[model samples]
Each structure stands twice: as structure tokens, then as C-alpha cells.
Target chain A: MTATVSYVPAPDAAPRSRMLGAQTRMELRLLLRNGEQVGLTLVVPLLLEVFLNLPLLSSLGGSRRIDFVVPSVLALAVMSSAFTGLAIGTGFERKYGVLKRLGATALPRSVLLLGKTLAVLLLEVLQVGLVCTLGLALGWHPHGNPIWTALLIVLGTLAFGGLGLLIAGTLRAEVTLAAANLIWLVLLFAGGIAIALDSYPAPFADVARYLPSAALSDGLHHVLQNGGGLPLGAALTLLVWSAVALPAATRWFSWE
Target chain B: MPPQATHAILAPSRPDEAASGPALEISGLIKSYAGRRVVDGLTLTLARGEIVALLGPNGAGKTTTIEISEGFRRPDAGTVRVLGLDPLRDAAALKPQIGVMLQDGVGAYTGAKARELLDLFAAYAAHPHDTAELLELVGLSDVAGTQVKRLSGGQRQRLSLALALVGRPALVFLDEPTAGMDPQARRGTWGLISQLRADGVSVVLTTHLLDEAEQLADTIVVINHGRVVATGSPAELVRAGAEGQIRFRAPAGLRLTSLSDALHAGASASEEAPGRYLITGERSPQLLASVAAWCAAQGVFAEDLAVERRTLEDVFLEMTGAELSA
Candidate 1:
């Protein structure tokens, strides 16, 4: 409570997008408010990068250590914020009747989707910023075009966010809770986040490049490591994943 | 007190100005799941500014009916109109004018503070009440910054009520509006509900508290087996059966043969306690006189003479043949 708690009389004339904007703001506030969520999404990536970059403590080595670890953490950050966090939160929202109640409100389902997507995008920006600042502080110089780096992060957010929706929107909360953490662990280790695909056997590395997590990490690694102007292959892979997962999530999503 | 006295309790100042149309109208609503009819051919109407309570036993489809009317669930047959618009097809247009207090969760983000949640919901409305005033209205002004998950049960109930009224909706749906409230909180909520009606907001609530329905609802709808079993004002419902009773305390061991012969043929009287007597029969001026005559003839001073008129509880029991909480 505060002296400034005075509120405006709500107008009956606000458009759908305005309602969506308010919802997105509230969602972002809530995501940031949860200490556990912040720990998993924001802090974990920073810690992982630091540990992975240390030659004495890290299995990763030598000249490419800084380059490899920084982009990988960025990808890991997107997965944490958009994929793991989004899925668990939404699954519980569905379980707790929050989604059911919102369904009764003036905001349409499309607006709810847009609001959540917007909240994820906003958080992703914060996540990228934190990872980049930490990477720069650790003496990891960027080699990629900033514009493409930004574009890849956006596409990567959408692609992983869609899969998160697919999981949260379809599964029961308990199962979703277990499966989201499980999927995140699997992606972090085998999907080419913690370790490089180049170290894998040729057959496995080929499969890893097709994974959304790998595409994001690989694309960011190349551009940021070499100042590459465009990451067309990684960009196309992310776009295709987005195209598939988004429509599929939309088709499968259930409000309650 | 007799049920008839309830009619004049408030002396409803505004001569029931007929609303433009019923705020909510449902006819032949039928909903089934897996070939079982959960809401079967139920119909009820709620007029503007009126408080109608849905009373029933458990699994009686009270929630199902409210859900269909709110457009959260679809009915297999029949139609529902909220503010003269289809609840489902015109939901986007109709929602702003309607407030719903969900029976669980208060529909809030667990991590969001109470004040933040109220403000967030306010922004979704075309016209919403001031968040501060709304919070104060529901007595949640003190806990504005408390996270939803951190609120007490009664506090959460109040918060849910505030969320519903924040939009100043023309019509509202409250499912068990005072289920977890303490006695004081319950009365406070009742006062707020009366105020909502005074402001011309229609209310439809489901409740297990018989006194709650009697005290608040202008009309009560009782459902059983997924169908409307009874619909009437409290007074009217009480009078439906028209069986009144007389109770008195007196010396035990009074011979019943004379008393039985002196009364109407069908009347039955029984001593339920050592010195207590109950007489069940048609309650009329003549029956009271006859009972008085019997007491005088027996030369017994019948202390604590009491007349028990049929009440809404009796009507509900007779209709559903089950407890309200069953």
C-alpha cells in the first residue's frame, strides 16, 4: 500500500491490444518476482558460463574457450527463460484455474497468447543483455554482426517458446513439471549446450545441427566468434522450427 | 417468525421497474459428458439488479450451469443469453459487462501482489472502478502488496470479490461467494452484495448456506438431478408445502386419546422430549384455536408455545429430498 495507490477509473473503450499490453506487463512482473524462476533463468546461465570458461575447472579448453562458452550460455539463457520457465509456469496456471478464469475475461485467447509471447520476448532481451555483459566482462570479444546476433536471439526465443507452449498447453501440471525439467536437462547436455557438436562423432554432430538448441548455439557461436555478417543456415533452421512449433502449439493448446 | 413477514423486510423502494429484459436467460440447457447428462434441460432467468441464488446438493450441476452461462463450457442443446447477447458467440462483447468470482484460485498470478493483480484486471475492462476504492470496498486495502499465494483463505475470498467488482460489471456470477469466509467476513460480503444490487448489478450465486440464500436472494433456484426442481422467492417457497407445526413444553404422561379426539382427524401429535410436544398439521387460524382449546381442556399450562411455519428449508428438502450440502 502506498500514497500513490490511487487508480484511474477504467474506461470502457480500451482496445484488445491495450489489454494485452497490460497483461504482458503483469506477466513480466510476475516472472521477475519469483525468486526461484530468476535463479533458474538468469543466474544459472551466468554461473554456467563462468565455470565452463575456467581452464582449471572446465572440461572445455584453450584458445576457443571464451568464444565457445559465451554463445552457448546465451542459447542456454533463451532455453531457461522461454522454454523451461514458460512451460512450468503455464502448466501450473492451467492446473490452478488461472487460464480458465482468463478465458472468461474480455481478453481473447489470441490476446493471451500474444501477451505471453510478449512477456517472453521482453525477458529474453534481459537474458541476452546479462549474458552479453558477463561474456564481455570475462574478456570474450564478440565477432558477429550485432544485427544478426539480435535477429538470431529473437528467432531462437520464438522457436523454443513455441515448444514450451506445446508442452504447457497439452500436459497435466505434474507431468509437465517433471517433463519440462527433464527436457531442459536433456537439451543442456545432449542438444549441444554444455558441449560442442564438433567433439561428437560425425553422425551425432549432423543430428545435433538440426536441433533448435544446437542451431541457436551453433549460429551464435559462428557469428559472435568470427564477426560473420549473416547466419543463414542457423537462421533458417530456427525459422523452420518456429513455423512448425508455433502452428502446432496453437492447434494443440487448451486453455483449461 | 412466519415466512410471510420476509416479503415486507426491505420494502423494495423502487417499484420493481421491469428491466429492459432479463439479464440472463437460459432455456432447456442440456450438457452431457461421455453420454451422461450433467446439466439436463435446466432453465432459469435472472432479472437485472436481482440476486438469485442457486441451491443444490453436491454434483447437482450448479457449476455446470454457471460455466455454460459464462461461456467457459458449451451446452449440447438450448441457448443462453447474457445481457441479451449469446454468451458464447458474443462473449468478447459481453465479457466487459460481466464479472465472475471463481470458486477457486481467485484467478490470480500467485507471485503477483494483491494490488498489482487488481490493477492488472482493471486495465482489461473497458471501464473499471478505481483500484484503491475497489480494494477498500472488499477490505483488502491493508494487504495490497501481499502476494496472492500468501493471503489467507478469507483474504483470498475477499480479493476474488474485489476482482469481480473492479470492472463495475452490469452482471456478476459468484460461485459460493462466501464459502470460506468467517462469520464477520461473511456478513461484510453480504453487505457488499446488497450494495451491488442497489447499484443495478445482477448477481447469480451458488451456495450451500440455506440462510445465505434466504437472506440475500430475491429468488432461489433449486436444482436436483441436473434439473430445476423449484424456483420461487423465499416466502413463496416456504408456503409451497403449507404444512405448519405447533410446539409446546408441558408435563409428561398426558393421555393422548382425548387430545387426538379433540383435534382435526388427520392431525398427529407426539411428545419428542420429556415435557415437549409437537403437533403437525395444516396451520390455519382454526388449527391454532383447536390446539388452544385442547390445551385448556387438558387443564395444562402449555409453556413456550411456538408455531413453526413451513420454511424454504422444508421446501428445498421436500423438493430435492436431500440436504443442501449433500
Candidate 2:
């Protein structure tokens, strides 16, 4: 066959920002479309927020049950989306060769990780908006600086998101699925989200407060429920988790 | 076949870089897995716009060699240069120029819609082919909205092919490109691959289908036991050291002594079965004429007379000592 056009021999990568944006959007779209993820990230948090506020359950002494329930549920939202949802989703993506395919593209590995983090962050924003709206409709009143709440949310996400990816990248899909759910359940009941940390015996509460989930929940509860200043102790715990987990994930994460 | 000559003829209008060197160059490539050498000191070069097929039996290191070239696996020893740049050291610069389709559905997002998946890959390139046009080219336009996991094996293979082209890559590495495809889809893919060559794209593909190698590759490399046993054009490999035979059906048990004398000294005749005769010799017009002339002299007509040249499959089996599919 005769050549119709000269070979240009020019193959340039797209701008980094464009690649990150496209990957983030694709990741978020898949996260939202998955029925189980949506239920876990959004619907379940909203349901728990309402369910725990009912008078049928024995209420802890509080100014208003809505205030306490709202903060705890917000913390729960962060954990479910950033840890459980992200873990299950990424585990299956690895199992199905999705990450292997992406490895061949021009998109950098850092960009892929950042894109998934950004997608998780975006989903958290939606979750926060919905949970806050319902809290307001239920006459919940929150105090403390909004910036503290934002900081806790962001750092909590990175900490949990990093750990989630570590599990997904290193373990089999079915194992990750089971472990993530089991961890979520264990943390929900014992990690100061569904129950106040003080309610636990002194020895148990001491260790429970160090858990990432408990740190997030307690930090949010101190700021949003008690109108307190920055909870430095809880913030430090989350910061340490993020510092350790992110690098471990970056070092050990396998594409296949 | 003088691949450089073929490259010059097919892509005469290409720029200086296209003429400067081969599209891919590998020297003394060696890779091992778990104490076993999967690819042992293999060397190959591919010219611009040439389609080279890596033909081998199972565990012959075709996939390992391709993976090293694609930069997915590191070589234990040797050098690999794709588009005149190191695949690992210069990967950021090289990845955009080379597309890859891995084996066993390793290159697609299972949860993504076909269109979305293509669009996502396209976003990684500065200038990409239109998604609709690419899908149409691969005959996957009808299933663009379907999730990748929901598509049939053939549809997924075509979608993978479409992904490899969306970036307008200069070279593409396709592993088993048509393994799960139907005959019609496979034909469409072959046409698309040929079009890629026409448009000045280099292709390196690994396949068990010897017919695919013979039908599409400009040069065929037959490898066995992690080493290249033979490398040549399809016609050249078939013609290399493989004798031609002429077979015919005639009345059995006829005296063949005179018939053998009528033909050349090197030729021999045999009747191993009832009413069947076989002639082993160099195939030529003179030999054919002698056979016809001898039959007439003996007042016997030869039925089902035909000349048979060695096929690529036969050559491959002889080289590999294993079936292609095994």
C-alpha cells in the first residue's frame, strides 16, 4: 500500500492536570454507581444518624442527642467511605486487572493514587453535605471552628485512605473485602463512634482512643459537640497514622 | 526479505527519525523468573511500520520478551530501546508513543463503560483519535455504553484494541490480539492492524495462531525453549530446509520402477496405501510434466494430483518440538 501521509513521529503526553482530572472523575463515577458503595458511604451514615437519635435507645447525657449523633455519624461517614469503601473498590480493581492496565498508560503512579484520594475526598464532601442537612432538619446545633472540622476530615481521610489502599494492594480481593467490613464493624462499636469512649472501661478506652476511627470521632465530637478548641491529642494520633500509612502504602502497593 | 527495503517502500514519505533507525531494538535480552530463565539472550530489531510476529509454543518466552519491551518487566541482562529511548529510564517520554494491549484481558477497567474507558485512556495523550471513530474502527460502536465486564470476550478484545490506538501511538505491543475473537471480528482486527502499518505504526504481536503470523507479519520469529530457533519472512521460513511433495491417487500396486526412472534421480515414488501414491521431490514445472508424461506412457491417469509446500505451522512444529497450542 502507498503511504498517504508522512509519519510525524510526535507523541506527547497530555498535561498532568488533565490526566489527574480525568482519572479522578472516572474513579468517582465508578464509586457512585456502585450500589453497595453508595449505601455504605451515604445512605448508611444518614440512617445511623437518624436511628441513633431516637428516644427508643438509652441516650447518653447530652445537651441534645442530635449534636452528639451528628458528629459521630460524620466521623463514621469518613471511615466508611475512605477506609471500607475505598478498600473494597480498590481490591476488586486490582483483582480484575484494572490497576495493571493503568500501569501501562502515561499517567504517573502518583497521579493515580492522588486521583483516587481526590475521588474519595469528593465523595466525602457529598456525604458531609447530606448528613449536615439532615442534622439541621432535626434541630441539631453544632459549635467550634469549622476549620477544625475540615482539618479533621481531610487528615482522617488521608490516614484511612492510605491504610485502605495498603490492604487492597497487598491482599486478595475477597480477603480485603472481609477484613475491611470486619474492621469497620469492630471500630464502629468499640472505637468511640457509636458509643462514647468514656463508656468503655478505663483500660479499653485508653487503647480505643488511639485507633484512627476513635481519634477522628473523638476529635470531631470535641470540636462540634463540646465547642472546644483544636483537639491536639486526637489530631496528633491521626497525623501519625497518616505519616506511617501513606509511605507504607506507597512503598508496598503493587499494581497487579 | 530485507526488512529495511520493505520499510523504505511502505513508508517512503516518513520523516528523518522514521528513517534513522529501527522502531525497536533489543540486544542480548535475558529475563528469569523463580530461578528459571524465561527469555535467554534474545535479540531482535523492528523497522519502522513493520509488523513482526513472535511465534512460539507455550512457555517459549514470547510474553516475557514482549513484557520487557513494553517496560512492564525488567530484564535481568541486556539492552532494550524503544523509539530510540530506554523503556524504563525514559519511560515518561516513551510511554506516550507506545501503546500496549496485555494478554488475558489485562488492559481494561471492568466497572467502566466502554466509551468512558476509551475516553479515560485518550485523556492521557495530547492528541487522541476521536472515541467514536476508534470504537467504530474496532466494530464496537454498538456496545459503547456497555460496561466492560458485561461485554463478550470478543467485544472486550476489540475494546482493548481500540484503547491501544486511541493514543495514536507509533508502536503497539499486542499479546494474543485475536485469541477470543470470532472469525468476522478477527478479520476486522486484521484489517485495522494492516491499516496501522500503512499509517506508519510499528507492531509486535505474539500469537499461537501460525496462520495469523503468516497472514499478517512482515517477518516471523519462531522461538523455542526461551531462544530463537528461526527468524525469517513467512515465505522464507517455509522455504528453508523444508522439501516439497506431490501426492496423487492412482491404481495401487502398479510397478513403480519405470515411473521412478522417468523422473529426476532425487525424486522417489511410493504407494503406502491402497490406490494412493506419494512423490517426494523438489517441486518444479519439469517434475510435474514428467509425472504427467509417465502416467500417459503407462496408460494410467493420476487423480487428485497436487503439489504441497510446507506451511508455517509445519515449520513451527518442526522447530519448537511442541504444538503451538500446547
lDDT of each: 0.83, 0.87
| Candidate 2 lDDT over residue span A29-81, tens digit each | 99999999999999999999889899765745577889999999999999999
Chain B TM, every candidate:
0.86, 0.87
lDDT (10s digit) by residue, model 1, range B167-272: 6577789999998889988998888787777656789999878899999999999999899998999888887767889998899977777776777977878888
In candidate 1, what are the lDDT values of residues A147-238, reduced to their tens digit?
A: 88888988998999999999999999989889989988998988987887777789998988899999998888778876777788999999
Q: Could you give candidate 2's per-residue lDDT for residues B1-326 as a string of tens digits?
A: 22233333333223565457798898999998999999998998899889999999879999999988888889999999987878889887778888889888735668789999999999998767668877877778889999998999888888988788777788999999998999998887887788888767899999999889988999998988788889999999999987778889888887788888998979888886988988878888888999999999889989999899878887888887788772
Q: What is the TM-score of chain B in candidate 2?
A: 0.87
- In order, the first chain's TM-score in every candidate is 0.92, 0.96
